[model samples]
Target chain A: MRSNTFKTLLLGAVFLGAGAVAASAGTLDDVKAKGFVQCGVNGAGLAGFGAPDDAGNWKGLDVDACRAVAAAVFGDPSKVKYTGLSAKERFTALQSKEIDMLARNSTNTMSRDTQLGITFTGVNYYDGQGFMVKKALGVSSAKDLNGASVCVQSGTTTELNLADYFKSNGMTFNAVVFEKQEEADAAYDAGRCDAYTTDASGLYSIRLKMTNPDDSIVLPEIISKEPLGPAVRQGDDQWESIVRWSHYAMLIAEEFGVTQANVDEMKSSENPEVQRLLGVGEGVDFGTPIGLTKDWAYNIIKGVGNYGESFERNVGEGSPLKIARGLNALWTKGGLQYAPPIR
Target chain B: MTLRDKTADETPRSWVRAVLYDATIRGWVFQGLVLLALILFAVWVVHNTAANLRAANIPFGFDFLNMRAGFDISQKPIDYTLDSSHAQAFKVGLLNTIIVSVLGIILATIIGFVVGISRLSRNWLLARAATVYIETLRNVPLLLQLLFWYKAVLSVLPGPRQGYVLPFSANLSNRGLTMPRPIPGEGFEIVMWSVPVAVALAWAIARWAKNRQAATGQSFPVFRASLGIVVGLPVVLFVVLGAPLSFEIPELKGFNFAGGMVVHPELIAMLLGISLYTATFIAETVRAGILAVSTGQSEAAFSLGLRPRQTMRLIVVPQAMRVIIPPLTSQYLNLTKNSSLALAIGYPDLVAVFAGSTLNITGHAIEVIAITMAVYLALSLITAALMNWFNARVALVER
Candidate 1:
């Protein structure tokens, strides 16, 4: 009687464990079956990256990348779902499969990728650490900052960079740390710190928040390199490839003169490279190997435009940020943005 | 033939008795199996972590602790730099947490005791004011209070160029509250050591006077004598050492204060938020503890010709402490844990430095998080152990 009872309990436990394994596997397969993509983004903070409109519609450089991926897979840019996450919760949200891809303005670092068990596909924005001080301080350069108090956001690469910069210069300075960017900005504005330090792009966003934007000037010095990119979970090669190719497609489109407005017109061109990119004639099998539609690159360019177009529209000369495309420009244009050939 | 049959029957009875007698051994074997299973599970987890780390091409070691932290901390209690190792950075973070918690606890206790006493006061306005204070602070989230203090209060202060002058050569500005810093000379060390010695002697004298009164039923002016010794001895040492301390007053220079010790506004806001929020809960605990003692006890003491203050001191406080101590210890632990919120305001607490920046730089999330959690757990356990010893001393003794 005892042996029979033990056998029954063992069978029940085995069945429950198998059920759990099957359920998890089923979820992954379900995601693959869905043609569209779900990408997480930061909502309505920094301009040129992620910001919301008066109607609450999100748009930015990162948001465009998510749309590009959605267009590549489902042939519909609107198929993407944007999950807005805070800094503290972003990693856990991605790890738990709440979002298939995180294309937010997340910094690409060894710890975030390897330690957090996430993979950064490629760099989207090349940034550097810089400081913004009040113009009245009469400080033209970061080297002048000796024993100056700096306001910085906590839990970011900027904090470490700040320490390294000050110590390397053998200068002693007080740091006023804040968890949120807004709080740090507020502190900086109130003169809690003599200067505010963060990513160059972040310094621009913060400067815009100042009541008198002209009063604060970002110093000429760039402290450390910050390569921002989209990240996906490990062990998901299919998803990673899709995200990577979408970004490359934009770069290739720009090299080939494909803008959102002119993509349809470019379809009739006789050029061999354009023919292959639009999936018009021969070598149309590139998208098939990646499980995408034949006109994947076409949909991407039409939906989100080329890389240069996206940059100019969001954060470049046309936007409030007015960020110059210095290192972010194409390699042909003496910039670092080069992609491997699609074919 | 009958004797042979009885011997065979005894064999069956012996087998049944053996089974019943071995039950204790069986129970012990079951418990041992459970312990072994737990140990094996832990080992398996460690093995998996090691394997995963190897596969990811990451090193599994604490060598990173000696590497430069490279991150700036805002309110380090000790001298620290980015050139310092990860270990030194952690020490700086831990010290900042300790500084905030210790200061918060002292302030909270004083506020709590006064508010608690006022809650039971005969005056209506005093009781109402205390009630309002407790209700307003305790209801709000601690994080919001921290934000309000940092943003709404401290951040609104004028810049150093337009510093607000307060009494006693103090200046309030967005930079921080700058006050006179006392510079200690060579002889100051000797005077400092003498003060503590005088305090110890006074404590010894107080104990001697109490024992004499208990034995001979005679009173001594212990309070007056102890106070005189503790204060007078410290003063005499300072004078004998030729008053080796001098004040370095802060002076405005260019756009900032040049001299004196400046307390950063982040530290001030964190302390204010922590103390005010914790004090409300502590006040409630104090009130409940005092109420736990029966009114009859106080009335009985009064009938014996003891004054109200004397009755409260000898009877009520001692009994009330029995109820108050356990909850007060938990409040202290909560305050310590809540110090992690210092990260929110960039105060460079343990979480902000070690678990945060170091974890990012090293990419060893699992190890860093495990270490941080272990540190907090150890702190909580130590506090609990200390409180338990105190509680045992004050526990009711029954025959």
Candidate 2:
């Protein structure tokens, strides 16, 4: 398929293009020298995750993840430049150091983490593969989808999960696989498939973009775990730690009930953890290990807001997707999103 | 002769320069140097790549092909499952590529010949229509055409629930065209064997008829008789065997048709796009081949009181074929290579399934890409070899 093969050749071209290789080590230094942190994003445009807006500004949950890293690095969320990449190009681009960070709504699987010459940071969004179908189809549960035709994107865990799920459940379904999510979406919209499947969060956003969002319903059953997150190149401990904790900073900010508007006010609080996270007066300097300033977390909070705020604005109740913060809520709220102590 | 003698006599003084002045020796030395450089470059590239991969810690190996592919290919020419090894998955992909390429080549050649001849038609409408078809198809990108056929035309057809009924109770839908599977019964083998017997009988009859015409200066209706024998033998045997055949027509079960042969829309679009696009180029080649055949040959036949149709069939086409076969081989190779674009429309061809999906799941880019490139190379070489054999058959034998 040109969708993926074209990307392989494109990556090979970039790989073979003389002198295009970036410095393998010291990405932080390189990013600093260039004065902008380059982040590769989803080129197929997963809206509410990594698609650009009408003004050509990248605005999505995944986009904010990169901005959060940039704020941690440069104390300015606007200092990041974005490169839209396909599923095929994302890993190769990261390995070649073509981008400092990758926030492409990718799943963090064991094979991807260990073998692809890159390491995923903390998960920005906890997701699972789910199905969406037209409301008139009368299909309510995944168990009832015995002989359904499901449109899914190829070359991803989604495809594998679809197969495994069907086999284990003793069901048979026709899979209409496309190399790109957009193609699957079109196929589903054209009534070529009985159901369209992707990450549950993606289903929400994709449904929001459909001609009539209210006509379809996201099935309640989750089929496969999809831990969507950002990643950095392997072999760079400093850069890896910095990106890892950037995600935690957003969660910790939410755990403490802080917001972008109230971040400065919360800086003066007496709680030792909050004071330390914000680098308040006489608090511990936790950013030294990652080679960032003490106010790195503070800058992230101030620039992009906390994880909950970003979630609401980009993909949650405040946005058109209106996805519930199920597993993405803070550990205090009994969700799975738990961060390490800043101290 | 005097200058040559003087030069030969003076050669002893410049014998050191004479060795360099020998063109054959100079050419051999230069070729050897070039070969050495190429070998060295290849060695260096291999070494450098191994070292880079080692540095990156991305283990590269072919052992992973034996592992489970763990994915479903939407379309396959052969039976495949998720648990099939990557090697089997690759075989399915290769077969899919072969089927599409073979069909595309056959369809393109047929259409190309007709359109190519129509381009020279005296009728204004036919000539203009052929010109329009060639211009429009060749100018547009094949990828766009494939997408248009897939997404806009085929995929937008009625869904499975509202599928259109075709002859023999087959169904056509956005899913695909499902045809009835023929179920052969008792004595079917005997009827099947009669087909070859009929073909052999037809061949012998044609030979005898040709010899008779040559010896007696007369003609036989060899083509019609051959066609009749081939068709008549199968029917007579099948009837004598009590019509021992039935069809298992596809019927809508739940989500899709069952007990039938289904051809996915992905393959249909690929075949259509590849054949239509390549036909334009083949048509141009056919036209050039026809023009290359001398007009004097046809004129001579016409002067002998041969009809125009007979002149074209007996005299002009045979000569034109000699010119057409060589370039036509290149068009065949192009169609095969272009089939790699199958993944765009979700046709599980070689590149899409093995190189694209399998590589991604395995995370073994070096091995995957190397194998894919080698397969394409082998396929192209094989196509060229077959065409070369065909070309040799048509080549003129001279005194």
Candidate 3:
């Protein structure tokens, strides 16, 4: 079974390799013809990130990003089919055209951006590698975990960062790796290791699944920068622009205070930037250039809401994860999330 | 004219007739055509793969093995770190696979033989229990059994601080089973050296005993003497060398046991799962083999004044072994291959380390997976070769 599964995956990769080089030229047309945008997402439940609910609906920041693209393309947020993939399968799924866009909580690394034949549209969630330890361990900082055993998901940036951080600090530690997030969580919960390391946002998400959530505490140190986002196959500039602008539209919507409820009311505002954003007296037909309707941004805002609203609803104070906005806040609010002017 | 000319004249047959009616020509033509088709198919797959890899910008080379793995593996048989080369990580994974499959093969064979005999036993409850074991375990999938053992059984064990103590100063917990590690001290080499010498001496004694029995019609207790010498020699060497082996007992540490031999729960769970699962099939093979032996042979031996145990061992077993061997060889190979399932439970087997985590990190999926498949093929071939040799040795000698 193992060999057969591996052979099938290898064969899929081979067939994808040939098709990817040809590069699906009319990806936007293909999505339209299919009547739904196939979006890749994290199959495992990472709370506030992409995860399925009891009713099998995908909900989170990344899911909202996929929905935003759907709204821009079809003018309906529900016009999407989500393909749940692991970190290892995400890129291949995108390259193979098994998925139109990948909105999984995947980091936008340089190698992935250039080498994997895919382009990350924009940073959906800025995260960093961090450690979550038992409170009784009394380890407040990552530096204190000198000889500790760390439970980590293999095949992730978190594993590499954990190794680098410990080596640079001259600490020898043991790493207990698991293939999946749930396995790692089970190991950590069963006390197989001293600490569990992943993205800080992931730590909070995982903590909610723990038997004793209050007994765990995330360490203060952030070891590595992880700007995770949605990605699409490269070489399709039209589709890339649409996916890229879907995120930019959300950010711009947030900048203009275009809440989903008031987006229609704000359509008649006197503000030039807001008017231009809504495609109402625009200097350039931004929507036409990106191959979408004039009210594409407005449609996105109405369907999936702005960046701040999605963040609040998914990972912020409005959700159970309750993660602070931190670096994900708008530039005016002293954060790194800055979108270009709509004009 | 056709029959007369074919026999009398040395004329070449027509291409169509030769290919259609000629046995030698027809077989070669068919084989050649099939080979050509196979080659064409292989070429197509390769061309597609190469083009795809080039398009994906993922270089199709094995140079990635030289790069650092940048990941941690828990069960390190040899010294390995995150800084180790991908090649080294592969070696660690291969070693772990060998360790589990080898241990699993030995344990499964023992269990299989015992259970197989019990199934044929006259004792009603024992036979029923053996039958139940064979039926239940063989029917379920191996992967589910591995998960049941790892998650349902091993994962439910208490943590390190509240570990379950076992006999012989061992401890069991979610972390693993920690036992005493025998560290070889000064003069330990002498005891190792004495083992081969003891075996040689035992062989000579056994040969001499067989000769004495043939000559005097009185058998010597050669087995007892050989056993004593083989075991006693190692003990005498150890004592003379001032008992040069110290036990490194596992002590409870911050989060786990420290300074001892730790059999990872992953390994234990995988070993148990694979061995138990394979043993069921092996038991059926043994039972069928034993049943194949004619009862008349056993009765004949008993009529010759041989005891029931002797009749079974000397008459029935030798005949039954021939039937049992070929299928048993396949079961052993299956167990070795199934050990790759350890990847699912995070046991860091060859597939997990190489095709899985290493491939994910390096993005050299094709090369890593190819290597992993090749390794399993090689492992299976080697096992088959060994088992075939054993089968040959145990087969009845013909004049």
- lDDT (tens digit, per residue) of candidate 2 on A70-123: 999999999999998867567777765678899998999999998877889988
Cα error, candidate 1, residue B243 (Å) = 2.5
lDDT of 2: 0.85
- lDDT tens readout by residue for model 1, B1-399: 443344566797766665556778778888999999999977766766565444334457777889877777766667876678989988887787788888998999899989988988889999999999999999999988987887765657888878899887889987788999899987898888888898899899989988999999788888899889888987898898889999999998655777787887878888899999999989999999899999999999999999998899888998988989999999989998888877676677787777666765665555666677788898789878988999899866657
Query: In candidate 1, what are the lDDT values of residues A1-343, reduced to their tens digit?
Result: 1121232233223322322221123323445577556777874367778877668777788888888888987788878778776454455456545677887788898767776657898888999999999999999999988878888876678887888888789877777766567767877887788999988987897799898999999999999999988988776676678788899989989998988999999999887778788898765657877667789899999888999999998999988899999999999999999999866
Q: Which docking category, incorrect, acceptable, medium or high, applies to candidate 1?
A: acceptable
The collision pairs in model 1 are: A177-B346
In model 2, what is the error at residue B80, expressed in angstroms? 1.0
TM-score for each model: 0.88, 0.93, 0.94
**DockQ of every model listed?**
0.26, 0.51, 0.51
Residue B306 displacement in candidate 3 (angstroms)? 2.4
The TM-score measured for candidate 3 stands at 0.94
The alpha-carbon lDDT assigned to residue A61 of candidate 2 equals: 94
i-RMSD of all predictions: 10.5, 2.8, 2.8
- Pairs in steric clash, model 2: A1-B343, A1-B344
Show where candidate 2 strays beyond 4 Å.
A1-4, A13-24, B1-20, B186-201, B241-244, B396-399
